[model samples]
Target: MTAVGKQIREAILATGPISIAQYMQLSLTSPVGGYYTHGQVFGRTGDFVTSPEISQMFGEIMAIWYILHWEMMGRPTKTRFVELGPGRGTLMDDMLRAAKRFPQFFATIQGVEFVERSPELRRVQMEKLGCPKESMESVKDKNEPDTPGSAVSERYGGISVRWHTQLEEVSVESDCVPMVMAHEFFDALPIYKFEKGTSGWSEVLVDVDDSTTTPAPPQTTSARLAGSPHSSASDNSSECHFKFVRSRSVTSNAAVILRDPRFDSRFDKGDHVEVSAESARVMAVLADWVSQNNGLALIVDYGQDWTQGDTFRGIRKHKFANPLSQPGSMDLTADVDFSYLRLAAQGKAKCFGPVEQGKFLLDMGIQARLKQLLQATTDKKVQQDLVDCYKRLTDPNSMGRIYKVLAVLPNGAQGMPIPFAPPSKEELNRPKVEKIVRK
Candidate 1:
């Protein structure tokens, strides 16, 4: 077993079976050897590349979107530019660079907030951002009045930077509106898998074995299975035989995993599945924060339209790996159940997009951005590299298809550019597609 696996085994032995959320939380945030805590996980040498790493164009387009929203908000005198999980601050750097195009927009930006837990990463972000020392502040509380230039003295003309461990910790002074963005943040939350069985819906849980190693085990239940038909089956015979089996028989044999079950009630026996209450709770908190603070948030991640399906996945060294292995060393992620997220945000904030990242980027003028980059580059090799990066980011065959984007707006706001239109009934009725669409 790997070092991470050994540590996880020891934990499970001491604490018994842990919730999927707990497992994922430790895997990414543990102080010593967790994925984000131990080493760098970005850039060319990292486990995987994000949109910001792929091309600056991604962040530039996002900045344009933010500018549009700022305009919609009537260009508030003071606007909080916040980013959740600002990894290495590349996205923020690109955003700031792009925002410079609109001097008025930049001028209206009073503070920058980053919701991150890693001190090491905070150091890297500060160094890269060139933010002045006095500008580095933390949010106080909702009750506190706006400090304005207190965090940054009159001498400091640069944007003030604030760090908070959680969204709730960020102080929202009166009269200052907030605009938050999270790129590939929601998908990183842990997901629970559930399978429909003759008995009911059974949850997939990680349990410690006699050897003290934890492995996913299916719990039996009798709840009706949720979600569309399974997309692809590794075992061909199972797919061919599924039609012949009775509903109960099919449910018994079907290995479907529900992403969330916090709101689910009905169930029987022999049902197998999973859920992510923790993810839902996180979204609720975010939505509540935005609504209460007169702010908006945009979430960009890889997920499907709030539809029923399994999209749990893991990555290590840029390759797909078993989530059960190397507990704290690999990245475990799941498709953000936009449907559930939308439900969670209902009545609190306005939700938009949940559209594919491909469509979102295309709509944001990635093609135009590419042309500009091509014109600026003189070397043939360098031009080709830029072209390749553009393709990797916006090509339907690449990140475009699997990854998705969603936006949340403060309730009652208008005039923002619509990222995408809802899919038509015909489109929804089309045959199911595999969750993982690899190049």
Candidate 2:
């Protein structure tokens, strides 16, 4: 058993079976050999690759999108570019390098900010963005009092900035507005899974499998049924294992979530619904920030409009794995509930999109950008790679259909940003073709 795995087992034995959210929180960020605390989690070499690593195009396009929104906000000066979970800082670096073309937009930028929780990734990002080690500023947040990477920093690729441990740390009420980017961020936040049973909705929990004669933990629905019905799994078996049980804990958050209109209430018996209280909290923060500061926030991730349930699964080496099998060895994620995000942001910021990524990029002049790149490079291999990357990013069968974009802006912002606007007649009637960049 892994070190974290054993720690989790002992924790459950000492207290009781833990909630899925608790399990995920410990597995992903527990500091003692947690997944993000100590390993490669991004790129082709890591367990999974993000869109920013896929191609420079993603960030370049995002730079343009930011510029347009900045303009719509009256070209606010001293604005901050904040990225949540900026893996290796690739997207921010790409955006900084690409946005240089727009002198006004690039010049008015006061600083950049990154919200990262991983020490390993934070170092990698600092190195990637050329942020010197001498400019570090340490801060201790009450929420993450023990994390080493929770400090702020100065300068990112020559752009001034700081790293924050939480969103609430960055002051949104400043004279300068914040342009926030959250790519694949929401999916990583822990979600509570509720399974509707005969009695009602019960939270799903991780329990030590009953395999020996030891006493059962508190909050377990029933007594042990194996190896004398009271033995511990650690005593009966050498291998560490766990199982899922229906939660009957008195403090289940299901009742509150179900009652709040922020969540949907259409689950039937035997149905499972996954909700991320943290995600909703972040959305609320974003909405409040944008509304007050006349800021902009762009969220991109692989998700649907509240169409999936029970998607709390694991990924190891780009393939699906049992989420409960290896706690800290794999990446656990659930689909982003964009509809929930929209609902959470309602009455605060003006939310646009939850649109398909393919359409969003296509409408935002990605095709035109691709043409410029293709024409600039004569190196056949480089050109081919670019084309392939473009296809992967924009193709319907790949990230296009699966990934989505949601834009949040102050309700008083002037006009709709590009791509989110209704499609033109010509755009609606274009023929589909591979390897061809559509205008």
Candidate 3:
């Protein structure tokens, strides 16, 4: 078992089973032993590959998208370009480089801010993005004031790259357009899973049983002695596991589960539904930010418009694994429901697209970009590699159909942004998926 796994196992044994959200939180962000707290987790060497790492053309196209959107926003003199969870900062690096072609648009931006939680990832981002490392850690939350380590500005190619752990820390001037991007971010937010029962809905929890086998690094064995009451005397073979249990009572919110449009009527007993309160909260906060600042945000991730099933799973070494088996040693993620995201942003901002990523990229001229790169390169192997990457990003069997893009702009903003068309009639008729049934 991993060190973090033992910690989690001990928690469950002592305090009873934990909510899926709590389990995910500790697994991904434990600060001391979280999967993301240390080491490299991106690109070929990482657990999984993101679109930005697939091809430079993806980021370049996004640069064009940003440029067009900035123009649509009247090219505000002072704007902020913020990226959430900027892994290694490759996308931003390509984006800023492409923006150089339009000097006016590039110069109009006053700051390039990154919102990240991992100190290790932030260092990687700084190195890859040509931004200098901060002398101290930034303020931890939005409500907190600048401490000794708060976001001091650093520049790369004349663009200031400010680092913050929370969105609220990135200062926005009055009327300054905040162009925010959250590529492959929402999926990482912890989600709550509820199983439909004959009586009602029950929350899913992680438990320990004989089938559960603790994963290894050798040191994790000591974790059992560190806290769990079921120490060496008990069967050492027991492993972390998953199970479902009913809550004490249906709260006012849980009473509304049947009404949530995210789940279809087809769901019967034992059907599972996952909802991410953290994702919705982030979306609400983002909508509020855009609404207040007259800004825009682009969200891209692998998910469906509406979903009903267990999408939560773990990824280790680019392969799937049982999430409960390897706490704090692998990446845990769930499919994002773009429908809920749109609903969360409603009234405060105009939500657009949740369009297929392949369609969005094609519409944004990825083909032309690919051809341009192909022509520039004379090497056969490089040409074939580029083609393969292009196909991987656009092919229906790959990321094309599974991944989606969403846009949120200030409520009264006129016209559609680039790569997003006016809403289709079918999309117009779809019912909005309201907030999740609070656990």
Candidate 4:
């Protein structure tokens, strides 16, 4: 068994069982062997590839989307772009580079902020975003007196950037507009599984499988984060030795989550309900931020508005793997419950989409951009690669239909963001005119 497995086993034996959320938090962030702490976890060599890594076009379109919203929001001079869990800062880099073409939008950028926790990932982002190593760490910015963690970086074309471990650390400004992006982020938040029983819903917990051989002893594990208890990140064994156990009675989590009046109907059909309290909490906080600061937030991920099936699984090297087999070896994720997200932000913010990615991109003119790129490049390989990436991103059979886009705007908003915006008078009446002519 891996050191992570041994530590988990020891902990479980010491206690009884752990919630799925607890398991995932330990596996992905544990400093001893945490996935994000030790080494690279992106691109061809890493575990998974994200949209920005797939192509520059994804970020360019994102830049366009933000520019439109910036205009809709009255084009504040000091609009800050923030990304949660920015991996290698690829998306931000691509988006910022595209924004440079539009001098107005680029000039409006006061600075960029990344809400990342991993020290290693922070270094990688600093390098990728061209923030020099000598850039002052924990350096106080006179302009932003409230942000003690803020570091003024002379990178990314002179735009001062800062990295914070938590969202609260990045202080908000009353006069500045905040635009936040969370691409494939919420899925990583811990989720609790509940199954309907004869009386009420019971929570699923992870335990040692009696059928599996457990012969290894515990190893010295390290802490991944200050508050997080972690196992060795090097302890991934690629074999799931854990078993799922259900609580005989209703759990406190189930009672509260399954009873949220705003989201009660969401659990009506599902025999199994996967609830992410952390996701909802984060969403609520985000809603409050946007509503107060007149900000906009875009969330892109693979999930449904409401789900009746199990979406919890593990991934290693881009292929599906047993989530319980090897504790820390694989990445654990569940489909985002977008309905839950909407409900969480219900009273505080205006929600748009849960739109299909294909529709969103096409509406944002991805095809036009693709054609432009294709025409500009003569190399057959590069063109083919771009075309493949485009197809993968927008094709219905692939990421198009599966991946979804959700946006959040401050309450009492008049204008809608692009694609999700209401149709113009001409657009609304065009189909009727065409029908009459055909008759």
Best by TM-score: 4
Off by over 4 Å in 3: 133-155, 212-266, 423-439
Q: Look at candidate 3 and tell me the lDDT of residue 154.
A: 44
Instruction: Report the backbone clash tally of model 4.
Output: 12
Candidate 3 C-alpha error for residue 329, in Å: 1.1
What ranking emerges by lDDT with the best candidate at the front? Answer: 4, 3, 2, 1
lDDT of 1: 0.65
TM-score, per-candidate, Cα-based:
0.78, 0.84, 0.85, 0.85
lDDT of 4: 0.76
Q: Report lDDT (Cα) of residue 191, candidate 3.
A: 86
Ten residues in sequence with the least summed lDDT for candidate 2 = 220-229
* Cα deviation of 164, candidate 1, in Å: 0.9
Question: What lDDT would each prediction earn against the true structure?
Answer: 0.65, 0.74, 0.74, 0.76
Task: Supply the TM-score for candidate 4.
Answer: 0.85
| Cα RMSD of predicted structure 1 | 9.1
Candidate 2: clashing pairs of residues: 212-231, 213-230, 213-231, 214-230, 214-231, 214-232
- Report clashes for each candidate as comma-separated counts: 37, 6, 3, 12
